[model samples]
Target: MAGPQETESTQITTEAPAKPATPEPKKKAARSRRAKAEATQPAVSKRSRQSPKAAEAPAPATRAPRKTYSEKERAHKLSQIEKTIVGGATIKNAVGQAGISEQTYYQWKKAAAPASESDDLKDLLALEEENKRLKKMLAEHLRKENAELKNKLGLA
Candidate 1:
């Protein structure tokens, strides 16, 4: 039994008790309310909602060339790649200038490693060259000393 102020919608008559209005949960009520509100407005399709370029077909992805070269040309290209990379340039730019892929450039560098020469062999060769130069210098110094000693000893 509701007061006269209550409308027909809220009136509780003596007739079979009307089902009590189920209280909606806060989250679901808010979401359904929003959906109902949006239903009144016109909706744009996904594609039409995008920029004008959306209608145009995308350009095909470009692939880098896979070119082969003579051994001499390959050497030249490797030098170009190494120079650019060691000079603080990007590997992509260096490889581009060398007309090779980054993979090829690394392959060339790895292959350039001297298989016959170990670290010990390399050190020995360097030391041998240094020893040879020092020996020549020592010979000259000894010759000058010998000449001075002969003159001093009256054997000149």
Candidate 2:
């Protein structure tokens, strides 16, 4: 028979009492395997020494550092390869001209090829143009949408 306001006030005051604080148990220190092994093993004196070479083995010599091509160099190399293709030169000739191995030339050529066996240059150029066009369209659309959003939010 209580009114709505009275019921609400009673519900608000009838929440569970606060929980009692509990004491935290202390943590035990951890012992490492290496520490246990050292403790179990017999100790050696500082005067007991081994030969320097026997104490530590020398590391094997590392291979020479690889050569990295600059962006200009890479572009020039690709251009030469493309020119060789346009000139109808053999892979050997192209490799010679580009100062790269035959394997490297073939690898680059294979990587550059499209799904079809047609000219890769045409495909690459078409892709580049398409990418440029798409980017331009996307930028314009984003600009318009951003302006609209700003106006809606009373930021303009």
Candidate 3:
């Protein structure tokens, strides 16, 4: 039989493993209170309506439009024009060498010519007027389609 001291040691070794300590209840109560507070707060609306005057802010002033051209494009066109004038290159040859369509070259020439006295400038102005007319026609078509859609949806 074991001695008293041996028995005590044996009892300590054979004792069931200690259970994990339970967390304090106060932390859980605090988290639950925070969740309840958030739940009670009002939700924000997604759609907001603005006053008509505020919505209709004046558009920015139109700035003078500048032509966008690459250095290669400018050089090629200038070279072609030089060739045509000095080397007696045909209009077709000049356009081909410039890497642009014949019509485009003519249009550029017309636009660049003197506005006061040149017939080419008069032709260019006529083309510009025609372009305006075409744009107006396209805008009207789109407006009609928009009106039709609005009527169908009962939003007119």
Best by TM-score: 1
The candidate 3 region of ten consecutive residues with least summed lDDT is 42-51
lDDT of 1 by residue, 29-116 (tens): 4458678868866575786658687558464465756667777787788888878889999999989877767888888767765633
Which pairs of residues have clashing backbones in candidate 3?
none
Q: After superposition, how far is residue 134 of candidate 1 from its true place, in Å?
A: 4.9
Candidate 2, residues 61-133: lDDT per residue as tens digits? 5566676766467557877877887899876787788887777656655654552346676788899999999
TM-score of each predicted structure versus truth: 0.40, 0.28, 0.27
Q: Give the number of the best model, judged by lDDT.
A: 1
Q: What does candidate 1 score on TM? A: 0.40
User: How much lDDT does each candidate structure score?
Assistant: 0.77, 0.74, 0.71
The residue pairs in collision within model 2 are none
- Candidate 2 segments whose C-alpha is farther than 4 A from its true place: 1-66, 109-156
Alpha-carbon runs more than 4 Å astray in model 3: 1-117
Scored by lDDT, model 1 comes in at 0.77
Cα displacement (angstroms), candidate 1, residue 24, comes to 48
- Sum up the clashes in candidate 3: 0
State the lDDT of candidate 3 residue by residue for 1-156, as single tens digits.
889999898777667345335754665444587788777765534442255653575644656576556656755686667677688878788778766668777766665555435767788999999999999999999999999999999998
Give candidates' CA RMSD values in order: 13.5, 33.8, 29.7
Between candidates 1 and 3, name the one with more favorable lDDT.
Answer: 1
